[model samples]
Every structure is written in C-alpha cells, then in structure tokens.
Target: MEELDVNVSSSEAFGIAEKIVLLSFISAVILMAILGNLLVMVAVCRDRQLRKIKTNYFIVSLAFADLLVSVLVMPFGAMELVQDNWIYGEMFCLVRTSLDVLLTTASILHLCCISLDRYYAICCQPLVYRNKMTPLRIALMLGGCWIIPTFISFLPIMQGWNSIGIIDLIQQRQFNKASNSTYCIFMVNKPYAITCSVVAFYIPFLLMVLAYHRIYVTARAHARQIRLLQRAGNPAEPRQGHQEPRQDHQEPRQGHQEPRQGHQEPRQHPPDQHSTHRMKTETKAAKTLCIIMGCFCLCWAPFFVTNIVDPFINYTVPGKLWTAFLWLGYINSGLNPFLYAFLNKAFRRAFLIILCCGDERYRRPSILGQTVPCSTTTINGSTHVLSFFFCQRRGGGPAAPGLAGQRNQRGCAKVPGGVGEGNALFPQSPG
Candidate 1:
C-alpha cells in the first residue's frame, strides 16, 4: 500500500510539473502577442515617416486585429487550456468562440487587402492605382475586412447555426457520464463548417495567392527590363568618355550641346538609379509580404483544413488535436510582430527606437531627404503632381505640355510622361 501511494504521488507530481510547463509557455505566447502588436501600432502611430506610406495603414489594421486577438481571445483560450474545462459558462463560450473567429478572419482579410493594394501599386498603371486606392477606397476596404467576418463568426456561432444538425450529438455528449455541462462544446455540421471555412479562410487565401502571383510576375518583368537597360547603357559609357574632348568644340554651339547634355544625363544616371531602386523596392516588399503570407498559411491552414474535414468525418478528430491546431493558429498573432521586426528594416528601426526609449541615436535619415523633383501633369482633365528623382525628358521642357506646374506640395516628384511608372509602386518610401 505504501509503495502504491508513493508511485501514485510521483505520477501526480510529474503531471503537475507538465501542466506548469504548458501553462508557462501559453502565458509567454499571450504576453508576446500583446506586447508585440502594441509595439507595431505604437511605432506606426508615433513615426511620421511610417505614417506617410499608405501601405503601412493596412499593416496597422492587421496589427490592431492581432492586438484584439491577444487581448480578447488569447487569455480565455489559455485559461480553458490550463483548466481542461470551460469554467466561463456557455454564453461566454459562444462569445469567446465568436471573437476568435472574428478577429482571425479579420486578420486574414487585412492581409488580402494588403496584397491587393500592392498588386495595384506594382502591376497597374499609376493613374489607375491612384484612382483605385484613394483614401476613401482604402477606408472602405479596411471596413470590409472587419465587417465581412461577422456573417461567419458571430451571426452563425451565436445563433446556434453552427451546431444546427449536431444539436442532438451535442446534447447527448453533454449528458453522457464521461462529459459534463461545464464543457464548452462547439461543434459544427458539414454545411456550417464548409460555409464558415470558405468565408473565413479559403476565399481570402485564394485572393491573396492570385494577387501575390501577379505581383511576382510584374516584378520579374520589371527586373528584366532593368537588366536590359543596364546592358545597353554600359556600351555608351566608353563612347561618352571618348567624346569628352570633342565636346570642347561643340560648346560653341550651346543649343546643340545643351540638348545633348540633357539627353545624355538621363541615359547615364537617372534610368539606372531609378529602375534599380524601384526594382529593389518591389523585390523587398514582395519578399517581406510573401514571408508574412507564408507564415500565416503555416499557422492557420491545418486548423482550417481540419475545421472543414472534421465535420465530414463525424468529428472523430481528437480533442487534443483540436486544441493543438487552435493554439497553433493563435501563435500566429504573436509571430507577426517578430516577423515584421526581423524582415522589414523600417519596422525594425521603429522597434529599436521604441525599445530604446526613443533615443536619437537610433534614428535614421528619412527618405524625404532624398527628394528629386516634381512635375504636374493633367490626366483626364485633373492635374496631378507626380514626383520623380530625375525626369527622363525627350526634349528640354516638361515631357507633357501640362507639366508646367511647380513642384508638388508634398515634396515628391513624378515622371513627366508616365515614364516613371515604377516609381509609382511606392507613393512614399517603400516600407
């Protein structure tokens, strides 16, 4: 009897130690999710340069959604995990489940919106992008990201629509000796599972895939064009060197010399620098976003696939498996802040500044310091000021007759005749 007691007590102690480890890990993830997302929001809000880039607006929205997930969803989830029972009652269970779906779906939708924004910025014409991604349009997109998930999350889950055909099974499980009323049971019929998963995950995933694919293609084409231009420009360099002495004689004809100088200037420097910079920016942005998208997929795809599959299989999926996948998805909220800080220089800089208590030494020069020149052009009867580093002009004056206006008020420049479409990929500095 004493031996039995000692063995049982040892097992219990081991179990308690295991539980402590698990709870500690969960708490760390929750804390990281909260602090990391808060930093993302605060960095954007406090940094003037980050605010100027419209793409960061989408990022801010994503962080906000993650922040809510950390605050409203994660703590309760951790509690349920540690307790191994739903102590919060049925109504709160519904609320918690609804919030989890809502915030996560909102986060996925925000990513889709961001991919769309980048697609328009990189793949479409500047005029089209400017028209399509206007402030009002952006605001509408953000609103849709938050609002669209309610149909799948709150409305369905709270109304018992998810458990429609499974009501009997749910009731049976609740009354069974092995289960109890304290368990927060959430089950879905096949139809509800499919509908909810499609709305919340699959559709947005498809859109993001398409958008990123097109962006990849466009960026590759731009890169190829840049390479060809570089090769062609290389041969002209030696020719210019040989012609330097001959320019002494041509100086007498100032008119001819001035035109040649203007033409040669762009061929020598502007196109190469501009195209290279634009290509680098596009590549960097694409890489960063793709990493984010990939992480999101890695984190959520299994849970969603299981979410759709478990219903068809009669919910034979183990409860432990369900918990594992759900918390895996939750970990994504924490992962995003680290992803941003590690992959994006701007975010990293801001993070360092924030962490260091806003030390001036952590500050870097703003992209605004690299301003080129701005020219105004009228497209479809509306005058728009375009900013560019160096205007590639065919002649002495502006590329278009309407480009006679002064520099843009925002201190940004544009290519005179839509020649700097690449520059339009980022209205401000690239994030």
Candidate 2:
C-alpha cells in the first residue's frame, strides 16, 4: 500500500481558531477529570461504607486511569495541536505514546472487572455480595490490571525496538556523517507496530465488550428472578411460627441504648418492590462504564490499527488522520468524571464534597436512623449537619442514623452523631 501523502496545510486564521478551541477543550477536560476523579478517590478512601463494597475498588482504579491519562497524554496533544509537530524530545514522545497505551488498557480492564462484579452481585441468588466479592480478590484484580500492561508499554522504550528506536538509529548514523538532519518518533516497519497494537488495544477491547454483554444479560435475569420471588411471596420472611429479631438485638441496655445504625447487617432486608429501581441504578453504573470503555475502544482502535496494521493494508490512513484519532481516543480521560456525575449519584455527591470543601471526605453520624448523634439543619439554604460517626460510607440503602454523613453533610457540623441514648459514634468534640 502506498503511504498517505497528506500535505498538511491550512490558513493561519483557521489554524489559530482550531488551536484555541482544542486548547480550551483540553483545559476543561483536564479540570473536570482531575477534580471529579480526585473526588471519587477521596470518597472511596475516606468512606468506610464505600470501601466495604467490592465494586468501588474498581471505581478507584478507573478514576486513577482517567487521572493518569489526563496528566500523561492530554497536554502533549494540546501542545502538538498548536505547534503542528512533536516539539518535545524523542524520549518524551515514547513516554507519551506508551502512557496512552498502558492507561487505556488499564481503563478497559477496570470496566471489565466492574462488569464481573455486577454480574455476581445480581446473578448469584444464595450467596451474598460481600461473601462473593472478597477484599483480596478485588486487590488482586486491580494489581493485575496495572502491573501486567506496564511491561507491554514500557518494554518497547527500554529495548530501543520501538518507533523511537527506529528513528534514533537512523538519525544518529546520519549525524555521524553530517549534522543537517532531524530525529523523530516515527517507526520503521509493519510487524513491530502491529504487534504493539494487538498487545495494547485490540485484545483488551474484545474482552471488555464481551464481558459487558454477559454482565447485562446476567443482571437482567437476576432482576427477573427477584421480581418472581416477591410476587410468589416474600421468600425471606420466616413461617408464621417464627419471629424476626428486634432492631436493637438481645441487648441488656436497650432502655439506655440507641437503635442499630445501618441496613440490618445480617441481610435483614431483601430488596422488594423497589428492587426494579435498585436494578436500574446498578444498570446505569454498568452502562456508564460500558460507554466509557466503548468510547476508549473506538477512539484508539482506528489509530492503532492504522498506525500498526495500515502499513500492511491497502488503505494508508494519513498521519494527521491517525493523529486526530489518537487525540480523540484520549478525550475519554476528561469525559469520564462528568459522565459519572451525570449518571451516578455517589459520584456527583462525591464531586460536590471535594470541590466545595477542599477535602476528600468528612466524617459524621448516619442519617437514616434515630441513634445518630447529629441532627440535620438548614444553613445558608443548604441542608447540612455535623455527624457523629468517625467514618462515613456511601452505599447500602438509606443509612440508619449512624452513617449518613455523605457529601450532603458538607458544613453544618453542630449536629451530633450516634443516639443521644448512647455515646456518640465518634468521641465527643475536643473543644
């Protein structure tokens, strides 16, 4: 196949306007990705409720990937958009391209892992999610995603066998003879580039799509089973001969003590009529991750294929065209957090907490139960309160009075945590 001979020329006015637009877009994407993902990281870290769930561990990895992509790739594309060439040194060029490859791979794998998490959560009838999604497994999956792809990206640079390698050997030989030439990051052959594409992009993409499709089918099936169980009769309720335990349990200090603070710990409540709604929320989270992964696949697929596979194919995609695809592929970095804000409640609240308070998390008592020491009040037209719980978690139905200190509990700290009947969830204020 003949190489694309694009002249790559435009009028000064068009170029300047294009640069301004691209620069603005890049800036906004960076701003949102950093702020949004940092919020997520903080929420997952500081909130015990969020950490208890396995799915959030995947969210943490996904946010990290988005943040990494913004820092590693977006700015370079912004600079190249203005200068119309790779002005940075050859080493940076390799690093930029490699980071793009590795982080994108990590992002896709994270989404795939999320799909798996949701699948079992909804599908397995007898097993509880906590029993299914153990801490060690989540940690192992995250570790595998990052550690595995790193070598796939970095080895090319270390061995001097990649694009930089090809250019460097040629440029140096020419320099030994004469000093009038240039050094760039262009690769030499079809096999080398194509191999990188297969390792970094195509295989992971195939896995993500298949994994999500399976997750969707499994979740829907589980939801249908749950609906059936409710319609037939509450499978969870015991026979007429038995009685359910009281909320405070077998306590000697019931008169002087507070009620339990969260969803009854030993699977006390099965999702009921609102099961559909819960399913919908879960589905939306899956969809958001799927969209994010799909966007990443589409954006980078063409560029990688054209860069690597095009050399062997009959159609030679222009360098500029491929570069544009590369930039588009990376656009996902900035788009992820905003997408979460729009689609996921937890993420939106998390974003608000970080942006408004300049911190990742604030601890308070639970909001849903009476035992919580803190009470709600309106301050400056915002619903806020100081909570008593030392650590706040985000998900597991409405918090009992013991754990509602989420993003909504931003500034009003005077409210107490734990029940007045007992000691506050946290120790009394120092002051």
Least well predicted 10-residue stretch by lDDT in candidate 1? 400-409
Candidate 1 lDDT tens digits, 1-431: 33422321221232567779878998899899989889989988898777876677888898999999999998887776566556776788899889998999998888788778767766666667779988899999999999999998999898888887778777554332333324556788889889888988899899988987876676566566556545544445667789878877776786666886665554446445645765675566557657767898999999999999987776777666777789899899889777644455667778899999989887877657754433434332122223332332323444321221222223333432222232332333342
Those runs of model 1 whose alpha carbons end farther than 4 Å from true positions after fitting are 1-14, 174-181, 236-286, 340-342, 364-413, 416-431
TM-score of each: 0.75, 0.62
What value does the lDDT take at residue 17 in candidate 2?
A: 74
RMSD, every candidate, angstroms: 7.8, 13.6
| Cand. 1 Cα-lDDT | 0.69
The TM-score obtained by model 1 is 0.75
Q: What shift in Å separates residue 211 of candidate 1 from its native position after superposition? A: 0.6
* lDDT values for all models: 0.69, 0.53
